[model samples]
Target: MLSAGFIVAVVFSWIYDITPGGIIRTEPLPKQKLPLINKKVKTYRFTTFVSVIIIIGLLSFNIIDSASARKIEKIDKTIAVLPFTDILPIKYESIVFDYIGNQITAGLSKIDDFNVLPWRSTKNFRKGNKDYVKMGDEMDATILVDWKAIEIEGEKRLTIEMIVAEDEKILWSNDYSIKNSWTEISVISTEISRNIARRLRTFLSLEERARINEIPGSPTALYNAYRGRSIAQNALYLYEMGNRKTDLSDFDVAIDLYTQAIQVDSSFAEAYANRAVTRLWGIYTTHYSGNELEKCLEDIEKAKSIDSNLIEADIAMGFYYYYGKRGFDNALKYFQQALEKDPANVDCLFYLSLVHRRKGNWDEVAELSSQALENDPASALFYINIGTSYDYLHDFEKAIECHNLAIAILPEWPA
Candidate 1:
């Protein structure tokens, strides 16, 4: 009976071990299927975050690049030609004096990166005084060329002095004397121009030289242009100094002079531009109707079409767009285009800053105005713009500083 009972016990144990319920089952722990999460979906989310980061980095880089480009665009350097003095004592030989001056101005203007004051303006200043410092200050000239010619016996002895000035102080002065026959005057003038260009190159950078040399024309065409330019320039001077009410007779004469210049050379861009300027002035200052404005635009467009690179055309167009039509967009476009053609275009930069200020872009106004000041350090207008920009930004200290600088430069302007 004991053996039988043991045997039954062993069989029952075997039966329990073989049963599916009695087997060591895992209790089916809620069938945890890893929360049904997809590995690829998580990978896609991570990849999207990385792509967004890359896109932001690219955008930031573009923004920085654009800012840097604008900053580079603002850099400009300029040089000037002072009035050529005639030391000749012959009163009737004033024509010769003007001839020599015209030659010198023409040669220098042909050199790249030079912002030569027109013969008209220089002649006007020279008519009043011979002080180099005062003339340089009035014209905002960086370099001054003072010339004297004495007719000795039958030969002409010319004395030329190149004076470099900064802040009314002469930095460097060099004197050169040349003796030549009447026929050799052009050769002598060419030599003088070459020497002055060399000296300018020494004082100026390579980029500046490139700018001066970029104008397109043959030597003969350039010389002829200068002749025509001198005529128009002299007329412009007469117009500027003459009063419209008291000098209406002179105005007619000045207009005739300008017309004569165009007759001398139909391709003379400066003459056209200056005539347009004079007409526009009449519209602005006199009883002229809007007809003058339309005619001015037509002449300027003609001038630009003749020579797309004419700086005067660019400036006149910029003025027409900015002040006449009040089209700031077109104004800015022409100004920027002019700047691209000649980085040292002070007028373009000046008006560009003004446009920025009018648009309420204080930072851009400050930047462009400061750049204009650098290009034309003696310009009171630049200082005024700078001060205005600072005032707009509510930086009273800087505004005051700019105002003081402006007053120091041009004490005649009202604060």
Candidate 2:
């Protein structure tokens, strides 16, 4: 329509002249001026009109495209939980920062509509430059959660905000007092997650609400269990980073912490499940001296008896089949079940990818590894696995690209 209107206007102007007296037919130019008139028409009139219309069209398109992008970004539910900034004294930083951040992330991961990136994905933004907009863009997250800790007398308080990643608009903000107990952390984190979900306009299933709200074991036992978990995860990260001695020492300490939690609360299913996995890792790393497999199975059974739907227990069972018995089929089944419960879980996704690789399902391996990387972008193992899958599928270019990404992330480890 616009082009047609422009053409009509051009033809009308060519055929008639508008003047103060009246509209009149355009008279033929004198012979002396004919060349100049022709030159003006040929050199500028046609080309200039078309160029102006084209520029207007292009500008309109860009404006529409940018508006559409902003609209989509506004509704995108992808979230990245940034590390909690601690303003307390040096001795109180890591424990408060890591535990609260991790618990909040776990709580948010239970929401079905939220693509909650794992804590590792946002670890790089903990210190130094704290630009939420840039961080969200780099992580491909539309929502960014920020947290800050302040000490008030003997206790600590946390201020949190869920922001629109594009513009740092606060979608939701709240503050909670932190007590010296795991139950308090659990309750506070769950509340914050629920608020964020509500702001995003997503309803939680009964099962998800129950899972996020579950406060298990005595306060002391829960504290020990979480501390053990933190240690075990750090040790595992170190092991992956080429620290060979991590399994021998740090795993032992983590296992002992879990043991303490179990002693305090005999029915702490999560602690049992965590211990089972840590024990299995010890066996996998060839650092175990006793019957770690038997112990792992016993813990799995104990955890199931305590809470049949415990995801940690299910994940432990999956790893048991994978690491202890090499039963890829069973591992796949258990991991799939866990994945269905917590679709964005990095551990479940990684374990499923590993099982698929063993079962010669290269496509499934690549797909699951890619999903794992979405949650854990900093994990070189996921990139390496993806590269391996591509190599098996004979896509050498993609394989090399993935390998290079892994190498870039961890130059110390040979991709």
Scored by CA lDDT, what does every candidate get?
0.60, 0.78
Q: Write the per-residue lDDT of candidate 2 for residues 244-292, one digit (tens) a residue.
A: 8653677899899999999989989999999999988887777774477
Every model's TM-score: 0.52, 0.72
Among residues 3 or more apart in sequence or in different chains, the pairs in candidate 2 whose N, CA or C atoms overlap within 3 Å are none
Tens digit per residue, CA lDDT, model 1, 1-415: 4334545654565455544555642233365654555998899978976875676667667777667656433422233445444454754345556656655665566555556655543553443654655666666666766666666565556666666544343333444444443323445555666676554443445655454444333333434444444443343333433434443333344445566656756776766776676555444444345656787798798898998888788777876776577788887887888888878766677778888888887788878876865654444445666777878888888788777876665465554
Q: Weakest 10 consecutive residues, lDDT, candidate 1?
A: 71-80
Off by over 4 Å in 1: 1-146, 151-157, 162-190, 197-256, 395-411
Model 1 residue pairs with clashes: 111-212, 112-211, 112-212, 112-213, 113-211, 113-212
